[model samples]
Target: MTIRLRLAALCAAALVLTGCGAVITSPDQVTPEVYVEQPSVSPAAAKRFGDDKAEQAYQEVTKFALEQAFPEAFLDPAKKTYTAAELTAGVAPHLTPTAAQGWSSLVTLALAGDADAQDSLRILQFYNVDDPGSELPPDGDVLVRQQITDATVDVEEPSGDSPERLLVSFRHEAVLAYAEAGRPYELDVTKTMSYWLAPAGANAGSTWLIASYDGRMDVAVDS
Candidate 1:
């Protein structure tokens, strides 16, 4: 569902769709919203990471969390979508209950054509059933050509949300393919996204799970 994030992990399954009787040849037309929340920064990355150990801890925890969740989270099939329970079950052990619940919301958005989905497998993308910015062919089946490259990661200070929180950001360079009025087009973009994680338990040694994620794609694929 996370066409974008899944794009990074190479784990999304929403490639070519058949059986609905429609051939999709176009990418969704996006509408820009004036107000999108910025990724929350509690103490600012540099200020908090002033301590090298804290910075290292965040990086280690992020890697550990991904190792635990990604293996299970990135298994969506092209014809099948993941349920909230399934998603939570895969990553909840590394995250808070609320974050676990919220993971489902991210999937819902991805299924609905939100570009903000988490990193996964697969390269092709399609529009969700709803979402104004998305345009799909009849029968809702589509095939996409997309490429995401140059992925980089950075660890920031803890989120301001509570005593224990950390934010990790992923950056990528992408070439998105789509169609408009039966013509082919490609968008060169830079996408920056992040995840906020919290300590699994009350202890410093506890594992971490993503609490929230914020994504922004800085290129327009509009009509």
Candidate 2:
């Protein structure tokens, strides 16, 4: 007998082959493989600047911010909740102190079941990964995974009123895949966001931190 399995993920404009197939004669012959796709950055934004140094910087910061702020879906079916500290720490490295504090409060309110907070953070969409009500399968691991399919990072130079400030924007398309009983289910998501960044300290070598942000995210799921 021959068995074939293929897992593909989109990274920017390139297609990434995440998992390969294996031929098995017996059911117990091989262990099942879990599909995972980490976020990826595109070079399209860097091309806008027309500078090699700027291109490198854009890719570096964009990837760093994505990993720090918007992480992939949770693959562990046993986990259900996130603490305020956990959520805050996940975003602290890329945000200013005040921004981090605000995010902490947001998570606190969401954890308490505040409807508005939940809506603002949009956590309930994929929170219950193991819910059977969604007609999830019972035999294999029920996991939720995400792939950053396409992404762009744009930078705006400081001018006029905000002479020293820099604006960085990230726009990305992602696919959220839910594997229920080992079957892949998918959803489409797109997010556009901008961050106002300033130096964390007065020193020239000080790192830039996100002071404020505005963004929108839309998810497309079956009706």
Each model's lDDT: 0.39, 0.44
Model 1 stretches with alpha carbons more than 4 Å out = 1-53, 57-78, 104-165, 173-190, 202-206, 217-223
RMSD values, in order shown: 13.6, 12.3
Which lDDT tens digits does candidate 1 get at residues 1-223?
A: 1333323421233421100112122223232111121122334544644445344535543344323322322322222455545444534455456654444555555556556353321121122222323333333223222222222223444446444445565443343344445555444445554555554566534555555554544554433
Native RMSD of candidate 2 (Å): 12.3
Worst lDDT run of 10 residues, candidate 1, spans 15-24
Structural similarity to truth (TM-score) of each candidate: 0.38, 0.54
| lDDT (C-alpha) at residue 102 in model 2 | 56
Which is the leading candidate under TM-score? 2
Q: How close is candidate 1 to the true structure, as a TM-score?
A: 0.38
Model 1 lDDT on a 0 to 1 scale: 0.39
Candidate 2 lDDT trough over 10 residues, lowest sum: 10-19
